[model samples]
Target: MTSAQVEKGSEHTSEEGYERGLGSRQVQMIAIGGAIGVGLFLNAGANIAKAGPSLILMYAVAGVIIFFIMRALGELLLYRPVSGSFAEYSREFLGPFFGYFTGWTYWLLWVVTGMAELTAAAIYIHYWFPDVPQWASALGFLVVLFVANLISVKLFGEIEFWFSMIKVTALIGMIVIGLGVLTFGFSAAGDTAAVSNLWAFDGFFPKGIGSSLMTLQGVMFAYLAVELVGVTAGESENPEKTLPKAINTLPWRIGLFYVGALTVILCVVKWTEFAPGVSPFVKAFAMIGIPAGAGIVNFVVLTAALSSCNSGMYSTGRMLRTLADSGEAPKAFNKLSVTKTPALAITVSVLFMGIGVVLNYIVPEKAFGYVVSVATAAGIWTWLMILISHVRYRRAVEAGRLPASSFPAPGGSKGSYVAIVFLLFVTGLIAYDSESRVCLYVMAGWAVALGIGWAVLKARNPQIAERREPEFEKV
Candidate 1:
């Protein structure tokens, strides 16, 4: 059925026909889980090694840009919440081509992102069961999470709520422990837990500002899924209150988790002590004399990976359903199961993610790095489209086309314009790095393929190209 089949005056809109089971608590927790992922728990050691303590500054600066991006997205959500999120907005504000491309690209983005998460999950598993093959662990974890996601979106939210709670609790513990070590000059971290560690080893920018800028792409990648909170507005029981609250609290989340945790870790251990592939959390726990430190941290990182993969499943399903409902994907994907969940869409996404298991067997150690670079580059595209779409949306509002958003972006269209420039700068950094250069190449191919697919879709279904935007309140 085309999404136009949605009954009028029902809570279910044509674009978001699924049940709105995501309550306020679930929405808030999911928003938190979206930002705190395997990136900080597993990959941050590498970022710290690359940029020194300056890594904290990179995260702060990147967090501000991300907040602006979310504000733009929040404004759009208040205007018209939908499960399709950015893709739907792009279709309405930009064109059918952009809308179609955004949906597919975002789907691909998560497919690859889930693979990365699985790869990292398996590695974290190895910390406990050294004998377990990475592929076996990857497969095991995938199957478990897949089952969890299939049951219901409520289950997905509950799982994520707990997953994020664990991560947040751990970070809070670390911050407290680190602060204790710093002030008392005693505790598990040894006498080395001095505040001077921020600039002690080789000054704050030990690797120099140039080195830090070079790592901005990776730092930004850590923030890839942060916008996911906006995507849940459709399912959220109360987006007006939940979304603005989530977006508004972003600065503190960035401050406490990324900035606070990193400060504690760096102050306790010298930057040189962090290994490229190892998690700094593990190192800090071990240094502080926590028993079974690696094992404890291994569990945390595992959940972090689980958190990301779980989110990937949730989003890809909603996105595919959005496409199918719009007549842009196979009609089968539009079918909802007993729980009003998009089961078929979720199943297809899971099957595709199984490719990560094979890659894990092929090159287990390097799999995360490869998948992350591409995901990051794809993420940059996703964020850019959101800001651009919001700019056009704002113009529509001003022209008396749609109502002024209740949750308008702080700086309005100009904020979106500035965020656009920052994202472009990050894109440049991705291109400048030789190791990360393949993402640009792959993105180009993906864009061209999407362009051709859009043309064929338009030819087959002319109505898709001539879709009329649904009317909303006038300013």
Candidate 2:
């Protein structure tokens, strides 16, 4: 294909009947909520046991890399903002096959991630109602989020905005309380709380660098849904203004939510006090002698879980519709409800997400860990596609094949290259860790499944195999 043909296909695709209902405030909160999840609230304790104070550094480093990834995505959104986001860019820059693979893989990522979130929410609810069954709680949460998503993009955005607000407000409160304890020594544990707690237990890097490095896989997992902002492009009221503003604030969000909050918590309660499967925030609050502290933190973490799962419901439906529009999925998926929401698409994804409730019933103990690893692995693939596509778009611009993005990524393609290498190294780390290795195995099976689907698709509809060249206009 000629450069002009490539350029033509690169222009933004029209929003396929989606209402631009998400406003700037809701979009900003969605970005914040994406960065904070059960990963930080629940999983950080386990990582601290493995990496000690060094887990803070892991989050900071991963945060920077996430910033780069968002910048790369921001550049692309300005070029062609679509609800499809990564999959659309993959189709335009890479080919039809890559696009199909990306769309389905992303759908799988959210579906499984939704399961993980539901499982987490169930566990949190148990803290309040020990008598309730885990499966019932999971099913209850799934239905609630599914209905919210089915209403309208506006309703989904509003629910997410408040869910995120609770998480952000709680973290800030925890940080402020911890700092007061350190500076004034007023709380019960204030006498023991000290900055030295970070290294006093076993010295920094207490578990060794290799142990700390292994935590990267989990750290990256905590940062999984941050890219959900890019998926909101088509429904964003002002993609050019809102998307960049949201992406630019990622550094602050990571620094405050992940690194800052962890620092204060570790200082308040030594790393040794943290253990796998417990929330460090809850532990710190209990240590500080705050009345009903653990319960409050549990409520906040519960919101975090619901927030991420809410996002899963929203994105999975849009992604399925994107696939349907491209003929990769059933045509019925592309239909819009009276509310302008993808009702059929959302319903199908919710049914798949309900499997999480089943897993909770069958293997409550193992459900979260099993689904989280697979979601992290799928997430890595999605990020890689975005970077690879960004690099190709940059090259196209250089060759005069396309126009430059208004929000050009800083360091241009080099940043994408560095982020790509970082992701590959993290993948290697996943393979190195025995526990996480299962995700790679699962991903292998997923790849084979998609490969067979692609072959069948090509055989059935030869035109589906051909890339449709659309006309492009400079942004």
Candidate 3:
């Protein structure tokens, strides 16, 4: 082989050494796709039930807090861009256990989320075929998403781009249609609902700030996947450029796409009238007298679920590679296929998704609710670690132990601690809310399970013991 070919061949495998295959558009759309998941498509109804019209403001507040969290993540990812970006940062900044815990924890998180997304796809399809077995739909999604992930990362990117575009178009369409109904009295549903619908009932904050506070749990869950951008940084073709561009625009994107869409819904429909039986987005369209509103929203939500499954596959594969590289997982996971993809990791992760089918067949009704609640809590835990890692990162930078990066987090270590506190507070609130209280218990149980697994792994692996020397030296 030619020298260049030899280099390329060697570069495609390993954890920290994979070729950068993701482009700017891929990174951007993946973020756009992953962040706007089935939550916004279906969970908006639940949020409205929590705080009424004030749900819109809750989304805005959650968006702002998550904005800072992403900023911290962006700065760290740029500083040490790698395949397991955040997990690697946790290890370097904190300790081996921190990295090991974060990586495995995140792996478990996405596995649960992937199953939930597959289940969601199945449930949506059931609207057309009420008699179709739920497992059939879940299994179908498992096969489709598995194939999409196993092929190539670029192909996944292409699919995610289009997937995200459809949802974005639907959301924008809803916003435009909603504004028309409020302004020019356009009636797609033969009802000219004015903006006054916002407060026509018990006023905007009908349930009071206490209820609004409770709804933030739903809002946080809605924003769970916003970090998909940072995870993509390692694989992005031009991390130095593309990562910054993607991260910089996060605030406005969330504002316009999430807060903006919710605002339009609140204005066009009273919170009292919001029902959990249908999507708020579809309800907005239906207000304009648009037939097949549910069908259109279902299609958009299906695409959203696909987008999430795509990212879930990508993240877990990379994280597995990181685990293998750190000697925290089997060395086989570090190997790549001839296609330069983490084939084994992808296959294992996708195969794990089959559990969704089993869960669906066992208890179809409660499966989604259980999976989403737990996934949301696990996701929040991952973000909390990212914040803590950033705090440590900033201190290293200030102590002159690390290079000053092109992208620096605003407000420094103190701000990072504030971000961490905010996330912990959110987690506590999720536990307090009756709807999401199960998440708190699941998170606690998962942590205990991980601790046990880690202890066993350490006892079995000699390499982990050897690796601990360097970790201790760093500490």
| Candidate topping TM-score | 2
- Please rank every candidate by lDDT, starting with the best: 2, 1, 3
Q: What are the models' TM-scores?
A: 0.95, 0.96, 0.92
For model 2, what is the alpha-carbon lDDT of residue 93? 84
- Local accuracy of candidate 2 as per-residue lDDT tens digits, 77-128: 8877788999989888889999999999999999999999999999999888
Worst 10 residues of 1 by lDDT: 1-10
Q: What is the lDDT of candidate 1?
A: 0.84
Between candidates 1 and 3, the lDDT winner = 1
Clashes of each: 0, 1, 5
lDDT for each residue of candidate 1 in 382-421, tens digit (9 for 90 to 100)? 9999999999989988898677877898878898898899
Candidate 3: segments with Cα more than 4 A from true spot: 1-17, 188-192, 462-475
> Over the stretch 332-375, how does candidate 3's per-residue lDDT look in tens digits?
99887766677898888878877888999999888877888888
Q: Over the full model, what C-alpha lDDT does candidate 3 score relative to the true structure?
A: 0.76
**TM-score for candidate 1, residues paired by index:** 0.95
Q: Report residue 285 deviation for candidate 3 (angstroms).
A: 2.1
